[model samples]
Target chain A: MDSIEIPKRIETINSFKAQGGKVAAVLPIHYSRALFRAFDILPVEVWGPPEVEASYGGVHLQAYVCSIVHNALSFLKKGGLEIADFILVPHACDSLQGLGSILLDFVKPTQTVAPLYLPRGKRTEDKQFLADEFRALARQLSNLTGKEPGDDKLLECIEREEQADLLLADLYRNRTGLGLDNLSFYRLIRSREYLPAEQFTELAQTALEKHSARNPNGIPILLSGIVPERMEVLKAIEELGGFVVADDFACCGRRLYPKGNERDPFLRMAERIINAPPDPTRGNSIDERAEFLINLAQTYGAKGVIFYELKFCEPELFDLPNLRNSLKQAGLNSVHIEVDIKDPLSNQVITRIGAFLEILE
Target chain B: MDKIVALGIDVGSTTVKMVGVNASGDFEWNYLEGSDPRVEDQVDSFLQRFRTETGMTDSVPLVATGYGRKLVGQAEKIVTEITCHAKGVFKQLGHGGTLIDIGGQDSKVIIIGEEGQVVDFAMNDKCAAGTGRFLENTAGRLRVPLDQMGEVAIAARDEVAISSTCTVFAESEIISLIAHGVKVEPILKGLHRSLIIRVVAMVRSIGLIPPLMLSGGVVKNPAIRKMIEEESGEPVILPEQPQLMGAYGAALIAQKIAVG
Candidate 1:
């Protein structure tokens, strides 16, 4: 894809808003679409510039700073962040927290700092805490916009989001028993970035239709790692015929945040997310990550695995050494790729993926 | 003489050091890496170097510390950097001494109370801004040699304050300062002073106290060390080869275990 296509999309969205539609640019990785839609906000994702030049005076952050934050900050400096009236931030990761502070304090004073504190424990206490925090955030928003975030409205939003998630989940299930190859599956995932949720869902539905007509093909492969900052990286993987069967990442290719009950949708959403199967924290029975990967690969009948590592994401980097070891011991064919979202579409990564795919084939 | 040799290996991000204290309570240093690659190999090569240097063929009881401590396979005990730092600092300054260690990747300020218990400590592990890595990166960017950067700072006629909290921006600021007819010496002095200023904030956060022992490779920079003292308005002690403090502490623990 051309580097300008994404900005062009943003431009189109802006022009549409020029004709009197409201445009609210957002970073969709950790935020709930239900919340954004209920606020009557258009959820256009904020991304890094397609091409980046060496900026002489950018603040030197820690080596572990997330590239997404770097790219977003760069885009903000380039006046790309004018589209968002308010930005929602979650403490999903450390870099986000720092960037949120910078944006609010210096870059854009109007940007909201709705600190999303994730639940810590596995109990009703955690649920209650999340529910209360979510309610506080909703109330703060309501006060700002003078729009009551009523229980009925939240539940209605949750139900609508759940429909989209359910359809996507069903689509994943449809491909499970089909013995489809890993490479083609990744392409479908890449298409999600270019196409909206509705369009992406329809394309997935169509692809499954095509798969149903074809004969059984390659082994199931689970693609796991930190969320890709740019879709171009995944497109490279897709072109190589590797299927990204499932992921445990927080970004794209996951369900939109689920909703709670009418009286307490945040609580319900927290519960659903907490109970989501194959959780990154404790999905595999084994404590050792290598054994976990090996067992997961074997149990899932995955012939190959691809780990997409985000540069500056310390937790992922720390986990990687062991994960790679386990994959090697399992005799599973695996490739580990390092990516920074700001410099996502490098020929170096593309060549590496091409070589790895050729070797696997 | 008993062939009891206890070795402390500290594999830090910037440099690695190992010390061997024999059964006689005399400590002999062996195995030091300065900007060396093949760290694991360096460790093994150092072991051989130790054997050759001391002419001792004894089984070395091992304790390892630092970021890569987990990779030191021969360590009988591996301790966290905080504990190792406290032990090392306490030994040097006695009890009730504060500790400031700036490693390549992280900076930590530790306080030891009476009876050598950890009173409180603060760590800035989230960034390399106040760490040795920041200095190293800035030096590279300025095209100034590592050994001369400190001396250059010491020669400053008038110190220019650096306002950037980040190393990347600081590098640009340094370049711009030099470009805008500023003398090189004062800019370097200012850079060192800036690091001290940043580190002092962290020290103040955890409550600074004296007889503070400066530990880590950065302590070698006397100009920076003086700047730290000036910033804190207190004289600070330094360990002999301060970078090896963590590893030495680990070795001390191993010695205790061997003796007991």
Candidate 2:
């Protein structure tokens, strides 16, 4: 099967809704998609539109809100999300939490909005809290779909998602052997964010089987960031003869979970979220996250690291200085570039990346 | 006569600066001019003047830096102001520490390592209040000549606090202060304080390292320099020509490349 285009994905969701399937619009990073799938609901991930003219969202949100939240609110204001049966906002960041309240109180007061509060700490109580939250979310999903998912159905969904996760892991393990450039690799993996679990698995399996042996033949670098929105950054890195051998983006590479065999599906998902990669906002210390990135760089033989920070992201901003110091101590060169989702990569940014590549060379 | 080994151009937001460095990386000659709306024309005119005055050939490697650096088609390489400023200041001061560059459009606090590499940096984001343009806007409102702002601000007996750190809001605040009969000198002093506070916050965010250095066009203001020293609590070291540091750094890079 050909890799699904964005419009095709949207069309598929719309057709599903037309055939009486409910669709839930999800905000970025950390939500249980298996529950949505088991309930026969399509979970469509929203990372804000590529272009945004924020008229209504600005009125509701602060000027300093990150563009992802602003653009998402803009999408709601413009009725772009009318096709979504309900909107699910995860407690991913301050911006998304605030967005959930805004949607609940003002923007879409009558719309069905579910907020999943994923526990941020690692205490014993935190585990119970997350498991309880997932159970609550499952109840909400059950209520929305008017169908309590049986154990068999939930297990089936979990198995499919786990298979997809393994396929993604395999792809990342053999990324260099796949012969796909940075942009193509990200585009392929990110398809899972929107595609149904089974379809995404098929895509990943096909991609893995067709792996080429050609090396990227470029200076390898580890890309660390929140999300890979600016495709131009990856393209520019390739043009500068640098290859992103590994990544720690919240939405893409860091989200994969190892195989878990817990009987209770909700507990399994909760365990997966807690054990996933170290994220700044998700209660991971700077040292832990920095060490994680350093190890990845070392494992991949990456010469340097590129921190693609999203503008106004307080969590990432707070972690950057210490991370840089740690990376340097680990004998790696690193550069940071602040990016906005709405703006394309400027020449100034491209020039900086080029110079960084030259330094690595 | 010193032979020009490489050339550097800084097409900044408010001004265009160019420099030619000798083979030994000493500054040979330089040019500074207000940025024109047509940057390509300005670059061509500047190059023509350089050729006519110094008889330099076009074969010298040219490196560009600044916001408008990409428009300089003649450049063999384009570098960001952050890296270039670090290189230039390290060369000038012969050591690395924290370098604060307040430019026409933006302000940056860059931490340079012992080897003159940019270890880390923080810049004012999508806001011009912490930059030279902040003071320039208020200077125009108060009818104080840009060059005289520093002297006027220093003469203030009692400084008034200008609260807004935004350029547009600060202009309105200035109007209000003038309407309330506040003296221009105190308002100017307050404006300098406001800008310095913002810049210092950035400096602290990156964690200040000494010896603190200052560069960019804004360093010409004695009030800015004094207030920065007073606020940051560090003696400010400056390049001989702070405004040309970006271009000078670019020239240095070009020299290294040519030699290699």
Candidate 3:
């Protein structure tokens, strides 16, 4: 993700901390950025940093744990997150839930750890359940920080994040025309993980301004998975005569939250996360995920879906076969490729992506 | 005889194949040899020999395919073995169908469209169980020569089950079977069966489109074709030269630009 000098994670964290702002080391998938900001905490997410030596995390975790959880714990054990004032672990999947349990029950680090439970369905009661959970987290933050922001302050923060997300959605809407390569586009998208909403909005707008009719003529494909970890994958895709036109990756497109209409801040946040795109991690059905993927592919003119996934991720892996079958039945071709974040991008992966693109060609 | 005007070389893990096509893109000349560790040097020597023998001093468009395609410095283009194999077989067979290419390093089942384009495909990832190496490793372990593995396997009346799908683990299993006094023929049959089962599973995943053709150096083994037919219940087809499809396809792609 280049040509745009997007602020580094370390720089963002230090800047926030220097401003007397507390940093929350958030784990993957969903969390309330507005709520965290309301309590003077900056939520910078950790998606395995993926390159860490996982031995420290391996000491506490079972051998089967996904590298994201292992690397997060390993990174923490190695003092990677010592500066954070809080750690937020969302129950996005069983592995992440286990990570939260391990942190609370055993490898208790110094940061205040909180686990957020996301609602499975988009039903009214589901939204209410997630709202209540966020409310409880708000109470936890209030106790931990001894500073309670009023509804007005909370709403102000929500408005800022919503504005930033609106810009994110705009970026997605006009992604192809932006002339951003897979790596650069993803870099801009994932900058949301650490950069404050206001800052992300500025960079996103600048990217949109540099838009051109020079959208790459490469075979358009959709990427669906927990995360796109390796930079080589993007480079490999481009080199192979293809580019990601759409994504269902947990770290990027899946987190494109729509604006919530509720007046209550927590309910608004819950509405956004619960009503975001259909995802397997939230226990969404194969039919729902497949239908969404079909629509996504059609909307973006993607020839097929590449289920690029991480190894040992049960949620994504569990839904893979059925989801792939459903897509095939609908006349959408799909392929599954797994990667261990601890390892470098292998030639096999490049060849798989290469062959898939060749098929689409 | 037509004059050679285009070139394609497939630098596979176990072997290197370079095929020359005439102006109309029919295979006019070809070369095959064990893969050398120094692929660039190997390719250079191959090109030098081609120039000396063919007597066509002018350079033609060259397209490289396979794992070591990138190492071929003289190539004007590089295409993946998947596409090259599909294109090669489609032209040779006179129709589109599911084509399985089981190389020494990896295996792929590609669904070919009517126009010789790849429609859909599946590949075994980072594993040798579904590939030629699976049988090659076991052939050495069973003390059977690589070329005779098929004949020895086909003659066996009883095929003992080999439980391990991993190439390395299958070697250990073969040892255990031999220690238990299992006949080498049956063990060889079991290994072939193991490989076919894995490849067929990949074929089924892509929902095999028939005419069910085979390619790659591994398909040179007669038993692989017969067993694939048995396992898939679909007749398996073969081109004139199964091992040269990748290079042939690459040559065809180069031919369009070379003579046009």
Best by DockQ: 3
Model 3, residue A230: C-alpha shift (Å): 0.3
TM-score between model 2 and native: 0.91
Give the alpha carbon lDDT tens digit for every residue of A168-187 in model 3.
98888887888888888888
Q: Mind giving the per-residue lDDT tens digits that candidate 2 earns over B1-260?
A: 59988888999999999998988899999999999988889988988988987987757888998888878988998888878888888998899999999999988888888988887777774688988999999999999999999999989888999888679999999999999999899999999999999999989977898999999999999999899999999999998999999999999999998777
- Each candidate: what lDDT? 0.64, 0.85, 0.89
Model 1 over residues B18-72: C-alpha lDDT tens digits?
A: 8776565345665677635566677787788888877888776888777676577
- Give residue B166's error in model 1 in angstroms: 21
TM-score of 1: 0.50
Error of 1 at B246 (Å): 43
Query: lDDT tens string, model 2, A303-326?
Result: 999888888988788888888988
The local lDDT score (0 to 100) that residue A32 gets in candidate 1 is 54
Please give the range of 10 consecutive residues that has the lowest summed lDDT in model 1 chain A: A1-10
> Candidate 2 clashing pairs?
none
Error of 1 at B152 (Å): 33
Q: Is candidate 2 or candidate 3 better by lDDT?
A: 3
Interface Cα RMSD per model, in Å? 19.8, 3.1, 1.6
User: What TM-score does each prediction get for chain A alone?
Assistant: 0.76, 0.95, 0.98
Choose 1 or 3, whichever is better by lDDT: 3
Residue A140, candidate 3: Cα error in Å is 1.7
